[model samples]
Target chain A: MMSANTDFTLAVEELTVSFDGFKAVDNLNFYLDKNELHVVIGPNGAGKTTVLDLICGKTKSTSGSIKFMNKELTKLSEHEIVRAGVGRKFQTPSIYENLTVFENLEVSYPRGRGVFGSLMFKRDAEVENKILEIAKEIMLDHMLETEAALLSHGQKQWLEIGMLLIQDPQLLMLDEPVAGMSVKEREQTAELLNKISAGRSVLVIEHDMEFVAQIAHKVTVLHQGKILASGDMDTVQKDPKVIEVYLGH
Target chain B: MSFMYEKLLGGKNGTVGFVLLATLILVVFPLALDGFRLNLVAKYLTYAFPAISLVLLWGYGGTLSLGQGIFFGLGGYGMAMFLKLEASSPENTAIQSTPGIPDFMDWNQLTALPWFWEPFNSFTFTLLAILIIPSVFAYLIGVAMFKRRVGGVYFAIITQVVSLILTVLIVGQQGYTGGINGITDLRTLHGWDITSDFAKNLFYFITCFLLLAVILMSRFILTSKFGRLLLAMRDKEDRVRFSGYDVANFKIFIFCFSAMISAIGGAMFTLSVGFMSPSFVGIVPSIEMVIFAAVGGRLSLIGAVYGCLLINFGKTAFSESFPELWLFLMGGLFIAVVMFFPNGLAGLWEDHSHHIKKRLGFITSLFSKNDTAAVAPKLEGSN
Candidate 1:
């Protein structure tokens, strides 16, 4: 099973992490194929975020391997993981508040990752054009000059998505991309996620099942650091175990 | 008008501040004050370097270093060592048992020049050391601390301890380091009499030029993508790291850069004041340097200079008469700045500059009203 598999973009095999004695993400085997929009839904303490954390190198796994494009991710640092074509958006809208919307997207551009490279990084046409395109995609083109701090809750959320979009990652992981957004904003975000997940793999941790049904190509219901159900949205929704542990709420 | 702003890294207000600072330091200060007072102002300007460096390190980078005096002392001591070596020429020190070593070394019974001091005999080496040594030291410290993710108040406390340790080391080693009194009587630079009023004025211009050049260089950095990243890292370290930026690298770079800037100021302080003492390299001076940044508006580079000037002038004036009250006053001023004027003088200026500009524009418009003869707003348009 561990034989170099190029079929999947991300393959997490026997991934287990424990904080002292408590296992946060227990021996989990997860696979994400190219262009698949996968959603991980779980109740509180189910270690939904812990899985994302382990995959993204934010938290080190006690044992097991996470391979992205067959590259070992467990040993790589967080920034190195990001540079390896993986982008993770936090549960909250994390953005540079002092900077304008244009700057927010511009800062996320993939070029000039080195120390001096960033110092000499110019806002040339290629960069400007890319920022403009991503800004439009995220519906932030009109508010490009606005300070991120002044943006509405939903706009800030979109702004963060746009930041990740600017990186053009092969794998995008968002934790509750529409947690605090309005319903209308949620619908728009669902639309945005579906549209952007065409070429790259998208892994999302969300609780909104209706919103999940709208976007998930595949769904995995996590229960106490273990996958209780995994399949298409409809099948997972109908599963008795998923219903008892998660949907029953 | 905005197009012109685009040409300069800081845009309109930044360029204006740069020019205003230049004029004040290079022109107004020299012409307004006598040579003696001008020399004192130059000495004050040396302190401004560390303050300005703090603006970048603390204000933008979000790393508060309480031991800037370490780098400042390094630069000062580097310069002092060279001057002491020069002053201790065989002819100048013929009375000592050892004719060529420093007076402190002779007093402490040193027979030969220490290996470290031998390199300082070369002027080029001394200048390079002044620029490089502090940055290297900071780089090592930055790596040790930042890589380990030791920051916030703990990082600050560690730096304070480092500065305290340095001060103790310098004072204890009376033979090698000039001790608590510091290296003194720097007579000349390249055989020219630096102690004279003529040299004082000359060094003043040189310091001003160096200060302005560095400010421009910093402005360039502050306007770059790196600058934006600094703000990003400050706000969200994890976000920046996930954004593919090695957060520690940026912190280390800024830390090292700020140290180099502080060292330049230290070297200048030694040159202008003709002394490098342990008193200037300890926790008190380090904290005072931080206060200078705070008072000037840590976020504003030029404000840092003004902060240094304002606080130092306050220090000199209040301390002269009510010597005991100076510390209390300084503490009061810091608290006031933090409470009310958190942005410092620069933020205050930034907050009100627009209103002032509008009022000035109104005054100018009043005077020019008769010349343009422009019509008032059209009230006749159909609503």
Candidate 2:
């Protein structure tokens, strides 16, 4: 087993990704500490999500090393990276719309994930209890049997979070978790993020600075496929390069 | 009783439909139809196996394989090879130059039985081959394409090509596979005459029993968490992958399972019909199998069975009277089904069954307040 580095739960070094002739991410370095919530803020096409995709093995980095717990993640497949203790929720709420809330959580419960194992799996008391517990945490306890498509936009976002929680990953990466949510929903999501980040690390790509200020322990401002500024929200907001490249626009 | 009925048949209406279907096949058909017509029904029901497989693979998994007939043909050939060997006993083949070899081998100037065909001499090996060969073939295809994440129309096109290749291979290798005519004159199975009326009836019963078993097995899979995962994968494959499933493995398993079930149908086809032909192992029959599933309701297992029977019955009836119009009519049916009833007959039934059930319940309440008062509330609550 690769020992989990106490200082850094995740570390990326010299990451570069170029699609065709245009470089989406260039020479990027990022890190997240244990129990810390790190936010990546940038304009559209600033490669904020691409960096998360690189760490989670969703996009192939042209040149880089992403180490999750001191183990290189770029060499692994998306599913393997997930099993290695990194969870990702997409930019859009990617919950199973046709399935019930209970089923959505049940699928992402992270046990019996193989083909034959899944076929023979039974919902035991322990699994049921865990599902209910997560449902309560996501504030969907009463809607467990309701189809996810019927869920409000904010509820779908929470359900996706609940899905990632069931996997119990040490690192949770959420892309634009508060996008399209109402102000109240954003506040609740902020609280939910802070509550869930007690023991694990969180990496969020968010456009909502207010939500980021509420939850982000450290903020990295990206500009033109590079990290233009890195500091606390107040410090990054004051950084002249960040202001000119992102906030000024 | 209600729990078992719902579990097995899918719901209350499903249970009623199942009971009606069961009675029609087991009681009414035997009593009403003569031997000739009964045999024809048995032949048609043999198709339900492939149709049910399509429901599991294409309907649920969202992997459309157009080479189902390849598996079907492999199964048919497996059983036919065994029966052909039995019929071509040394005494029976004494007139041929190769007295112990099948007649086709003699006609093709082959002196010895092929080594591959030697295994078919054993009934156990033939049965196992019927289940295993097609699954192995399907496994290879599934792995090659799914591992690389090739799907959608590309997968469908490749499967169609595979069935075409199999047909050409069978036709070209006449000496080995009995060619265009196929392995015919399969008179017996272990010295028992399969052509006899009593044996035909027995095989028909066995076929129906096995078809029911397969249907139940399919229903069990479709209701399981595995089935839900399949639906999730169909909708958002990346989400399923990130949820820690090797997506290719699930596709492979379902593909192989579908192939095995389709093969069983092919085996039964050989036994009841006493022949196995390349015509059933090609692109045309494969697409026909898809149509059966589509018309029945790709998502409905019971619907697939009825779809196969209805289509086959129409084909037989139309071809007998209006042979020239059969092709055009089939084409029209395919288009109409796809355009108007995308979910097939089963979807149509489910659409209106709620209102039908409600009306029926109200009528029943008029007749007897106690039963409707008890049943009506439960039905409303479930919806």
Candidate 3:
């Protein structure tokens, strides 16, 4: 793992998001270092997902400045954020269920995500080969031709991860990555995250303590739209406030 | 084999088969049917145009527009005005003095044609009016509605009001619009004798080819990324907006395209029926177009064509047999289709055939394997 004192990859300053006169995320501030696997855990309605939404440009921050690699992210659209190397996976698998696994990965490629790209059937062999290679690395080669809907819940989640990997984003924000996954699948996901964290900055939103411990190098606990605590897993887990909110005190 | 059968039955091939069947029936009907039936079929083809537009807007674009009839009316009026001007008296001096010039003008005691109606005297001007007026109206309404993010049921209601307003305006304009009776007695189009069989046949062919072209164009759009984006918009509009697409622009484009298509259908209908009237472009007819699309299969392009033919044919048959219960029958059909087959008839076929073959193959294989096992046991025991 990279040293703990490395330069920040993502920096947020006083981010707030409001909807219909009600604030969802309020005056949040955080910084994620390069090659760090960070976890954001909180109770329901704690603005964890909303923070990710702001970062991914799904929801514009009411008032804030988000800088990624010293570039302002507030003005960028979702596709622009994606092009700038930020990948996000929704709580539910947001893949094309009718398409084959390989086709799903192929569709996630930056070029294929646009209007003209979807119409034309032209194939970039290098991209295809890379996708195939990634699918193989994720042990999805056998299921490459299978429709995404037919895959098990665990496989679908993995396929979504593989899709994000193909985009080759500099930062990945995964929401509840292991919500419905089996124990074995959870371990595999943890291992996958560990493998990818070597070169990329990962912000994982997970509730499972064991899964977070296995992969997260640093953790931030959010409660009611504010950060309650932030530190390494052991430090955050021992915090009385973190325990009372996340786990029964 | 069963798997292959399932693939063939459930896949795009089924859609192709349906399209091919429709083309065959349309091509052969004129040859076998008498002139009256041929004319009715031609009328159905023209009606199919508006339905086709609805399919693109509602079925594919996911915007349920109820004001398509307004565009249709505009096109019809445009053509009617030009044709009436052409058939007017040669001595231009009488054009201003005659109060009973077009009967409606006499009823209202009007002195001269409306200024707006003057330009429509030329065929070229009328044709341009047919395309431009409806498109501009749709574009303006679409921009306003979409910019405000007013969609779904709100959009439907607004469009309904638009059609209602248009119908009332046309009906109240007794002097120029021919009042509730609307402008009729369209004897000729660009000097072609519309009453002649050759002209009718020529128009019928034109309608058929145009319908085919629209269907192909819609299919192309549906298969493209824009189509997928539209579907995404339908599935989740906010997600699409967040995905960096200009949702309002897409909506406006589709609305304009739909209006243009509906206008073409309207022009064809006027030419074929030899009249343009308020009744044909009223609120009821607008709703009927929605029913045509809904009954056929909203998502299927072929379904739109099928729906138009089926409903029109059923209407003709029922009205002739029992006019009072015709509405009841249509209502019942819609209710039954909606309650039982949510995906419509096309969806029903897609779901059934694949599973049926798989079950049949499984049963046959099971019995054959059991017989083989029984013979093997008997042979082993005998040995």
Candidate 4:
């Protein structure tokens, strides 16, 4: 994995997102280096998800520039950003319950963004082989043909991660990837994230400090729509403001 | 192989069998019924057009359109005007004249046919009117509503109001609209001898074929990726919009498609029964279309067809057996279905089949050496 101190892969300058009259993410500035697994910790309503939403174009930043690999991201739509190699997993599993594990990957394939394109498109063997290979890596190869809804919650989370892997995105933003996972599943997910971060950047929004300490190379603490601290998990967890925010002081 | 089988047979062997049986019954129905009854069924099928429209709008698109009757009325009234003109010719003066001037001319009391009404006097013109008028209206309404981002109950209310306004305008201009009596005493439809048994059967067959074709088309659309996007839109409209899909365009396309379907049904209705009335295009009938779709299972294409058939069948049977109790029974049935089977009959069938499968599996497991122990380890591991 690339070192956290390497040159930035994603740079956000003065990013702000407001809903109604209240600002959800206010003038937040951050930069992520390539292959870095950055954990964003925030108390409830701290705008961690809002930041991810803005980055994925699910919510537009009011006035700011988001540069991904030096390319402007603010003008792109969510689907366009997805096609441009940015994958997102929602807090809730967004996988199609009726579709099989393999079919879920197929639906997110980058080639079918257009209506006419999808209608005429056929899945090539290369795409199929790649999906299977990724599923195997995620320990989901056996469940390829199983309906997504029938999968266990932890399995569903892994399957969603596998889907993002299939998309082959440069950056993957996952919201609460292991929120409902068991201890073993959380460890497995952390291992999977470590393996994935070898070739890509991963921004995980999580509240679990132990899980963050396990895999996060660097952590940023968000409070009331602003960054309170940024450093290694031990250092940030020990920060007075971070402790007070978590304890509702 | 299982996927292919499920896709072709609609998930189960029994479902395919039942569909085949239903198709056979419909094919043979016209032969058993008298001409009058066959004609009524044909008319009901025509009404199914608007119901199908409601299915597309409400079932798939998640837009409950209460203005389908407006489009239906447009087609019906358009055809009625032309038929009235043809029947009121100098050579046919012996036939009964309307109480006042023909309904189309009553509002203005024009001595000469309006430029717009002039073309409708021809069968070809009337046919064109049926297709164009409803489609144009749908396009305008769709553009206005969608561009403004008016949706949900707001959309439903707007559409309902549109139909309501049309009904009032038509009824208030009794001279031009035939008022409450509506256009009746129809005759030949483009010299087809509509009163003849052969023509009635032909119309019935045509209606059945149209219904089948539209159902098939709807199925084709609903199974495609566009259909998935539509469902995604229903579940997460904001997500779809953010995904860069032209949500407004999609709404307009679906709304217009539904209106066209409804208009065709209306034209068939007028042709078969030889009458066009304001009641056919009012809020009540529009609401009835939504009810049909709801009862049928709004998510399934086949459900729409089944719902139309079931509702119309009940209407016919109840009216004949106990006329006074018909409306009460229908209302009660609606309430019962809504309260007990929120997903409607399709969901009931699914739940029943799942239970049957569970029972069968349990029985099979009792005879086998390996059962609970084999599956339990994996279940525990997953947890």
Q: Which ten contiguous residues of candidate 2 chain B have the minimum total lDDT? A: B374-383
| Worst 10 contiguous positions by lDDT, candidate 4 chain A | A1-10
- Model 4: TM-score for chain B: 0.85
DockQ of each: 0.86, 0.80, 0.29, 0.22
Query: Cα deviation of B16 in candidate 4 (Å)?
Result: 3.3
User: Candidate 1 on B1-383: residue-level lDDT in tens?
Assistant: 54335434388778888889999998899989999888888888998888988899999999999999999999999999999999999999999999999998999999999998999999999999999999999999999999988999998999999999999999999999878889987898889888888888988998999898878778888888999999998898888999998888899999999999999999998888888899889999999999999999999999999999998888888888999999999999999999878898987776566445545565778675533233222112111
B221-306: candidate 4 lDDT, tens digit per residue? 55555666566677656545534455677778778878888888887888788788988999888877877777777765566566
Which parts of model 2 are misplaced by more than 4 Å? A1-6, B1-14, B357-383
lDDT (tens digit, per residue) of candidate 2 on B233-315: 98889999998889999999999999999999999999888899999999999999999999999988889998999999999
Provide the lDDT at B52 for model 3.
79
Chain A accuracy as TM-score for every candidate: 0.98, 0.96, 0.93, 0.94
**Per-model TM-score on C-alpha atoms:** 0.95, 0.94, 0.84, 0.82
Report the backbone clash tally of model 4.
1
Ranking by DockQ: 1, 2, 3, 4
Query: Model 3, range A100-184, lDDT digits (tens) per residue?
Result: 7876676565554554455553456887798898797677999888987899888888888887888788898899999899999
Best by lDDT: 1
Deviation of model 3 at A35, angstroms = 3.8
Interface RMSD after interface superposition, each candidate: 0.6, 0.7, 3.9, 3.5
lDDT by residue (tens digit), candidate 1, A79-182: 99999999999999999999999999989999999999998898899999999999999999999999999999999999999999999999999999999899
Docking class of 3: acceptable
TM-score of chain B of 3: 0.87
